[model samples]
Target: MTDHGPTREELPFPDYDHLPITGLAHRIRSLDLAQLRVVIEYEEAHARRVPALQVLQTRASELEAGAEPSGGDPSALAPELSPAPSAGSSVSPATAPGPDIPPTESDEAKPPMRG
Candidate 1:
């Protein structure tokens, strides 16, 4: 019988090199102090890579210590680049309402249907 070598389907390691490090760093930087702790815990459990873990741990510590700038602050090394909401804007009606369907006009006070 001929020996059948392991196929690519049997590859043991997942390819992480292709992951977008810059994008991840931006997201991590945006996390609040509490959320950052959760992310750090997840990183420790799964990937556990030294360099990446170090970066996350350092940022988390800085946030916990109140030494880190807010993610949106331009002074931050990796500033949050997400768009900012306009000031004094009310919450949009669609999202403000709960998952339940909103009441129809019939449910509210209405002038009797015009002829």
Candidate 2:
């Protein structure tokens, strides 16, 4: 296949090389078979990362066997990957409350733990 200059940056995850194996599998759930093939070809041609290629190949097989894409929306993240939250009422951790701040007490007024 003539690569014609398609780069890793053209992938759904431009940082695909940086993704952990588990993360790669997770992100691949958002891809259709065609998109998956683009990645597999890219990996074979340029980076040639064996582990990643295996994952892509496995997933592509599953797709060929009639498994459906998670229907994950591939537009909500990574500027290219768009995995939408599966539920309407999903509360992302980004929207969750942070740690509670302890009330400030005057240093002199605080009782010491020592005897």
TM-scores for all candidates?
Answer: 0.40, 0.57
Q: Where does candidate 1 have its weakest 10-residue lDDT segment?
A: 8-17
In candidate 2, which residue ranges exceed 4 Å CA deviation? 1-5, 74-115
Total backbone clashes of model 1? 0
Which regions of candidate 1 fall more than 4 Å away from where they truly are? Answer: 1-19, 68-115
Q: Residue by residue across 19-111, what tens digits does model 2's lDDT show?
A: 666668878998999888888888887777788889999999999999988867543455444455686765888889998877577755788
Q: What residue pairs clash in candidate 2, if any at all?
A: 73-82, 74-82, 75-82, 76-82
Where does candidate 2 have its weakest 10-residue lDDT segment?
73-82
Best by lDDT: 2
Alpha-carbon lDDT of model 2: 0.76
